[model samples]
Target: WNVRKTSNKAIHGVYEGVTIFEAPAKIGLNQQAVGYVPTDEEWRFPNFGEDTAHGREFTQSREGTFGGDNGTKSVLPEHKVWFFYLQRICNHCTYPGCLAACPRKAIYKRQEDGIVLIDQSRCRGYKKCVEQCPYKKPMFRGTTRIS
Candidate 1:
């Protein structure tokens, strides 16, 4: 999950005749923009700056305002804003934290490929694996039982 470039060409990388898709789990934001405004779902690109009322604030404005074009009103103009996207993926360590922290032995590493996996049937929703995972890959999705 090492996606350094912002464009789609950098987001998905092809390796060994296989296309790899990177889904970012963490993002770092910096930079600034000028005269940028948000658009509604109906709005599409190449036709930007339409339907400003249908926009949502990325971060709360500096003055606690909902919509503004300048930095004084909001954090910064939309165009100047920059976000550093980082993708997180399992490293498949020799001794995985999720595998060790699972109380019910629900998590395991495959012998052949060394890929870590979870056995849902053995999981008791303890969430120890989720807490212990350094990369925060083991997420708790709530109970599967129906009442």
Candidate 2:
């Protein structure tokens, strides 16, 4: 949701190698502390020769370059990078609790909707949602990077 760190801003992820990008700006955005976090939708798929999975592989800027240096810095206006993370990727919610609480009856699911949504207008930002939400979905954006 919102930033959980301030002093030690670390942009972390895992990748086998930089053979191809799941998306353009995958590196620059990540380096710039952009929001698009890798999901199953943006992963390195299996080989195309095999029938496991199919995905296009993009060409790199140059040959022989294995990895690029992530130039991350404090986004304190004077710094070079702005730290940010998008709170959209739902990790299988394996018995998620956020779906378990909603006194306003605002948060609901639709048979055709196929996804859980929160009614922002009803959200009092009681911040109880922050606690109940194991993933901390209810984040309020602000200047300071505090939970």
Candidate 3:
């Protein structure tokens, strides 16, 4: 999330600080990797890649099919094959379009922390916020009829 080139116009002049952290080693496909296991008390804290109340926050798509005309064999050399993944998340902009577009005023940003939140009680299932948001962060939940 580079703020300098972000699409959110409100934060165009704002400078956000970032701290880099080392990522966990990649695990082999279809195999679980050994790692830290939190206790019941510690489990209250959020863990990276854990399932959220909204289910998985991230979505993955296969860029393209690899391998063969024969259906199981690879025509390309093993050395030439490569894989890439791209992940997207909410930017939580200084001035969120979702907040402004919500006719019911369900979406709001906290002045103290600047975190944007939605009031499910106030939401009427109108998707104006979803239509206005450029980043596509405010997803509409059809099951609950809210955004």
Candidate 4:
């Protein structure tokens, strides 16, 4: 709801590895439910397998939001289940991984707020900081190889 009010960015859920808020699901015996999410009324199944579950799986990349380079799809079990949403944010660690991984000394940790930041002027765009970040918060722009 906050996402809707703030930037109005489309909020998508990571289901079966893909970034999607709704997907095809099986509801009850021989009944098909289209575009299912945890918030949906049909998501709650009185009985397990007979009521609700996804019929097929659509695999997505670990960087699901960006759809990265590693997206894939596969089959998954069909059964009623409850999905839990887990949110991950930048930890702003005392010893920041991004700050430590920048070979060009481009990333820094602010003393006041302890927020990790990148110095774009010095950034060679090696994406070492992107790789080192556990939450995968750092983003690389322009090109991958760095001109």
Candidate 5:
């Protein structure tokens, strides 16, 4: 279901008994360098049964067409292709590496929800947080020189 169609202000949804929440918008931030970061404009919903090039490659790898007797000549049937969609986001761990890596103490976790956030003003564009975060959630904005 498209949440924007229902309400632009809404940021949460339920799909197949799983609750999904939208990531906060990063206005004026060029997030191309960041790995798989979600924006308010784009929601990373699981697209099941989508026939993508990566899906085709995954199917071939699973069927052993690349290294087995088939070599590279075998093509798996379209109906036999099996792929699952995974939506990645910050796990908000009890011990956040991003928060711990910030020398300026720019990154902090909220006491209530435990949401990790980087204080932009205090951040000196030191990419320690970016390097330490396993999920690669905190991104460095080169234009602003802050992470």
Candidate 6:
């Protein structure tokens, strides 16, 4: 959402992180200090039909998908303001919610390695596990390659 130019809707400035502001949120667009949407998380330099590993579809997601927000909700500035920290992914969890949500009886933690896997043959992609998994780990891949 580089939005190199600004609009009245949601202005996603990249000067720092992807900072989205609602219609009411105002900023000087023509100013030299205009914000730039962070490219590290959301975009990758498209390699033009050459890099299969970095396909077009994959590059489309170079910018991380927006979640938990309704797209540029609102965040007013204040001298003594505090903002909610965004959630970032880390490997460990005390009570793994994903392992318990697989309905096919497919999910289990490895005794030796403590790893969990879903049996593709048994998975119906009903997304029951998607909804039930508290941690939101069971990603529902739309690609036929997975199912």
How much lDDT does each candidate structure score? 0.48, 0.39, 0.52, 0.47, 0.54, 0.41
How much does candidate 1 score in TM-score? 0.38
Model 2 C-alpha lDDT per residue in residues 40-113, reported as the tens digit of each score:
22222222224322223231224422222353222212222223333555543433344444445445444453
| Tens-digit lDDT track of model 4 for 1-147 | 564465444467433541111111322123222221222222232223333343223222254322223553443444343332122356877556566566787877776767766776788876666666766566553323321
Residue-level lDDT tens digits of model 5 in 62-139: 553433334545554443222222223677876676665667879888877888777888999777776777776675
Off by over 4 Å in 1: 1-88, 143-147
| Per-residue lDDT over 107-138 for candidate 6, one digit per residue giving the tens place of the 0 to 100 score | 55555665556677777765555455555455
Best by lDDT: 5
Per-prediction tally of clashes: 3, 0, 0, 0, 0, 9
Worst 10 residues of 4 by lDDT: 18-27
Task: Assess candidate 5 and give its lDDT.
Answer: 0.54
TM-score of each: 0.38, 0.33, 0.41, 0.37, 0.40, 0.33
After superposition of all CA atoms, the RMSD between model 2 and the true structure is: 23.2
TM-score of 5: 0.40
- Give the clashing pairs for model 5: none
N/CA/C clash count, model 2: 0
lDDT of 2 at 94: 34
lDDT tens digits, residue span 48-110, model 3:
235533233332225332333354422322222112111235687865667666678798777
Q: Rank the candidates by lDDT, best first.
A: 5, 3, 1, 4, 6, 2
